[model samples]
Target: MPKNKMKSGTFIAMCVVTVLFIVMPLFLQVSVIRNAIAWILSGLRYQEYKSAYLGLVGGLLGSWLAITGAIYTQRKFDREKEEKRAIEEKRAKEIDKENIKEICREMLWSEIRQNDNSLSCDNGNFIKAIMEKNDCYFYNRDSHRITTDNWNFIIDKVISMDLELAIKLMHLYKYYEFMTDFDGSADSAFTKSQLDFSKYKECYQDVVEYLEFPWAND
Candidate 1:
């Protein structure tokens, strides 16, 4: 049988034995049990009638043990569920990291070819025009001035197929965009901001147009 059922059967058997040995003899007027009870309660004022009190205490203790065991089992189940959730979250993060790596690799090589004028003639001028429009400012702490090196580094890294480096550069640009507006203005920093969308739109269009490459078809 199942372990739970076996334990329940054992407890029932024990309770039956206890009731037969203790409670049954008390009502039957057994001499030996009566003498034992009398000796156990000899020092008490209510010595002749302590069996009921003792039985009550035993009942309370048994109920407490059962309740405590149930609480412990519930906690064990909750802990197992929490551990399983953590494992699933960890697996999902690993899969996301792998996918990001693959996308970064493909985009990097495509940028490199486009930058070097090695891409198809139809797409070469389009890529160069978009790169020219890709301008953003960066902080130059050594020079104590804001400059456009952030945009330059991102473009270079992307063209070199260094996706990790490109992401880092992009973060730097985002940081400065949030930090200071050299344009001298005090406004809601993150509320409403403008982006030069021309370059972005052109690049996206180019990507869609080039999606029919022979390798991509395969």
Candidate 2:
């Protein structure tokens, strides 16, 4: 039999036995019981009365033991059931957390690749044209600040797990923001910002390489 069914069966049987021995006799008027009560009431010998009283005590004791055992079994079953349910709930939560992490990883990876491609092509052209002291208007017009939306979505998780990566991404994205907001018409500001672009590009490269070999960070 299953453990639950067996536990229930044993508990029920114990309850029935306890009721029959302890509760039923109080109301039951069988001839044997009636005669016993009469014998006691008639002032039977002290020795005989003492033996009968001892028997009653033994019967009550047995019933009490049966009740105690039944209660213990039921409690044990309940405790085990609660523990099993808790274990299952914890496992389910772990699975859900892992699923969220997986989704975040895929999304982050896509954003990284997209930004890396932009930096290598359009952004690279703009930086090169500026450094060469050539007309950079067309190159600058074709390039824009990189998107940081995807990184923002999972920034908290990334920072919690990898502080170094988080810092690198922050520096790179901040530089992109500066680039977008920089006054390109001011010669002095444009020269300073263009010079800093190399540093931002280095930070971006660091993040990409770190992500590529994530185990090294660990």
Candidate 3:
């Protein structure tokens, strides 16, 4: 047995000896120990018929507490299991989204890298096509619009990922919107010479650099 059990047994034995010898013989001369033992026994037996209901109430209260404790423990375990499952599912989704982002980056950057670097008068058509207020520009027509749907699917996810990249992408979006609005206006010129190309180049580089290569191909 454990030391606590041994100690408890020894203490109980000492208490019994004290009750039988010291309390019975020396301290309680009028048989007080007997009276106390009888009183305890009578209480256990519910002394009178009318008072018996109190014992039943106490028993029912103890049972209700035990049932409550059991329910609480089960609920706690279920909550922990649910939390673990949610965490694992989120991690798996992030991994899948990261893979998709990599593919989109490769396609977008492939076009950006190959295109004209200089902001000369020679690249007017390419610039307007990109900055045009239509589905074609936002869909990345110059890059064959490859994986554009996949790109949209992960955009919010990407914004939540990298701070620098998110800032760059936001600026690029603002510029794109500005160009679209400008192109729609009657005051707009036949040539988009007023637009700055270097600013766009920086945004593209920031986005491309932040994107990771797909695991299978990398």
Find the candidate with the highest TM-score and give its number. 3
lDDT of 2 by residue, 148-193 (tens): 6776756666665555656776777665554444434324334666
Q: In model 1, which runs have C-alpha deviations exceeding 4 angstroms?
A: 1-48, 112-218
Ranked candidates (lDDT, high to low): 2, 3, 1
Candidate 1: residue 77 lDDT (0-100)? 83
Model 3: residues with Cα > 4 Å off, grouped in runs? 1-46, 49-54, 115-202, 213-218
Model 2 bad stretches (over 4 Å): 1-45, 112-146, 150-218
- The candidate with the higher TM-score, 1 or 3, is 3
Task: Return the number of clashes found in candidate 1.
Answer: 0
Cand. 1 Cα-lDDT: 0.47
RMSD of every prediction: 15.4, 12.7, 12.8
List the global CA lDDT of all models: 0.47, 0.61, 0.48
Q: Can you write out model 1's per-residue Cα lDDT over 1-218, one digit (the tens) per residue?
A: 96655555656665665666556656549788777767767766673457677677678757755765575566668778999999998897666555544554455445433422321123444223333442332222333233433355444645445454455545434433433343311122212234332333344334333433333322
lDDT per residue (tens digit) for residues 4-84 in model 3:
455445555544544454344355456776576556556565456424654565565556455554555566687789999
The clash count of every prediction, one per candidate, is: 0, 0, 0
Model 1 per-residue lDDT at 54: 68
Poorest 10 consecutive residues by lDDT, candidate 1: 183-192
Worst 10 residues of 3 by lDDT: 139-148
